[model samples]
Target: MSTPVIFIHGLWLHASSWQPWADLFTEHGYQTLAPGWPGDAETVEESRANPDAIAGHGIDDVVEHFARIIKGLDTKPILVGHSFGGMIAQKLLGLDLGAAAVAIDAAQIKGVLPLPLSTLRSGFPVLSNPANSSKAVSLTPQQFRYAFGNAVSEEESQELFDKWSIPAPGKPLFEAAAANFNPHSPAKVDTANESRGPLLLIAGGKDHTVPEVVVRSTLKQYRHSHAVTDIIDFPDKAHSLTIDSGWREVAETSLTWLKEQNL
Candidate 1:
């Protein structure tokens, strides 16, 4: 039987953002599931219309939500995640949830250090306001452009923003930022878990939200683990690498890597 694949999306995007990716994987003989975070709207339009639905969710809530779904699968699936979703995939892997996993432009977890200026700037919308922690935060088109579409053209950036951007829960961002400082942080992961499946971390060179430095730091954290762990870098790509016009290339790269692992 073909291995099932679960696609986890990041902030500001619902599961619908993974539709094209789902279809692409299906065409390649993989069954796919792109489940939304708890309280996520069914569509981007709905999410935009009712931003409150996306508010107040934190890292722990999201992790448990996805963990329940994975537990119901008959077979251990191959996990694929982007941004914050990538961090979720790592948490799940530490729990021995999947057969193999791929994390793309993943957000920083507990041990990651060296926050770049661009990363801070990208998160300024939510971090700038202490009150935002309990609220949902929406990004302006310019913020989206800087954080997610810097590698693409202005027209393309606007198109992506209009089609996929939505409000995201601010609590998660705040939680992730304070992870290292909080001993009981929900963003903590067991990077040394020997049972964790083979993992691959993909980095986007131009990604402002989760820069290469952050990705490298995450990889460094897992260096002590016995589980197979590797990284691939796309020097010209940005945070939107998984959803941009060239997303197919990134998907194909992941598929090839999975095949090489005999997944």
Candidate 2:
């Protein structure tokens, strides 16, 4: 049977945004699927029409939802996730739930200490308001540009914003922000899993939201583990690298790494 690959999307972008990657992976003889977060609609238009449907879901909720899906699969699958999805992929992999995982510009998990100014600003739309924690928040075009499109041109940024953007539950952001303070925060990952699957963490140096420094810190959290951990840096890319015009390059890179792992 072909290897199964599951794609997980992060905040602000619909799960369908992973369709291109899924197509490419499928062509490479892999069976792939991209499932949205809990309460997500089947399409972008439907998701936008019901922001309330996307509200109040947290990091743990997302992880468990995906876990249930993984359990139904024929075998342990390869996971590729972006942004918060990346974080979720790591969490699942840490639990030995995946054959392997690729985390692209993943959000900060517990034990990640560098909170850069850009990261803060990128999350301001949700973090600025306490009440937002239980609400579904959408970013403005300008906010989207700063958080996900800064590395691309203004025109392309606007195009991306219109194409894949959606309301994201603010609860995950709040959970991540206070992760270090909470003993059992949902954002926590078992970075020290010594026998888990190999993991490749991809980071965008120019990404204002989850910068290179944060990615490096995440790498350090795996120091005690003997399991394979690798990192790739796209120095000029931003948070939008997975969805922008340069998406193929990132996808190709991930495919190459998975091939190297013989998965």
Candidate 3:
């Protein structure tokens, strides 16, 4: 049987954002599933209309939620995730949950150093307000432009913001930022686990949210692991690499890499 593929979305975007990716992967003969964070709405319009639905959820909540979904599947799936979801994919892989995994511009887990200024600025919306730690924060068009659409044109940035941006819980951002200081933080990952399935970390060279420096730091942490770990860099792309006009290129790259691993 063909290995199933599960797509995990990041903050501010719902599972619906992965529809095009799912369609493409399905055409390639992989059954795809994009499960949402707790309380995510079916549509971006609905999420915007009722932000409360996605509020108050934290990293642990989302990780457990996706874990349950993976556990119920007939076979371990090939996990693909973006941003925060990418970190989640790694966490799941540490638990020996997936057949293989791909993390696109993944958020940093504990032990990753070299936090860049651009990454801080990208997360300012949530970090600036302490109250936001327990609330959901929405991105302004300008913020989204800098963090998620820098590689796209102005018109395309606006369109992406309107269609995919929604409120995201602030707790996860705070937890990730403070992960190193907290011994019990959920942002911790077992990068050295030998049982972690083959993993790929995709980096966007121009991505402010997860620059190459940060991604390399993440890669460095996994260096001691016996599991297969690899990285590919798109030097001109930004955080929107997964959803921009050239998204198909990124998707194709991932598909090709997975095929090489015979997953």
Give RMSD to native, each candidate.
0.8, 0.5, 0.8
Q: In model 1, which regions exceed 4 Å deviation?
A: none
RMSD of 2: 0.5
Query: In terms of TM-score, which candidate is strongest?
Result: 2
Off by over 4 Å in 3: none
Provide the TM-score for each candidate, comma-separated.
0.98, 0.99, 0.98
lDDT of all the models against the reference?
Answer: 0.92, 0.96, 0.91
Residues 1-263, candidate 2: write the lDDT tens digits.
99999999999999999999999999999999999999899999999999999999999899999999999999999999999999999999999999999999999999999999999999999999999999999999999999999999999999999999999999999999999999999998999999899999999999999999999999999999999999999999999999999999999999999999998
For candidate 3, write residues 1-263 as lDDT tens digits: 76799999998877888889999999999999998899888888888888787888999999999999998999999999999999999999998999999999999999997889999999999999989988888999999999999999989989989888889999899999999999988999889898778999999999999998988899999988878999999999999888889899999999999999987
Encode model 1's per-residue lDDT on 19-108: one tens digit a residue: 888999999899899999888888888888988878999989998998899889999989999999999999988889889889999999
Please give the TM-score that candidate 2 achieves against the real structure.
0.99
Clashing pairs in 1: none
For candidate 2, the clash count comes to 0
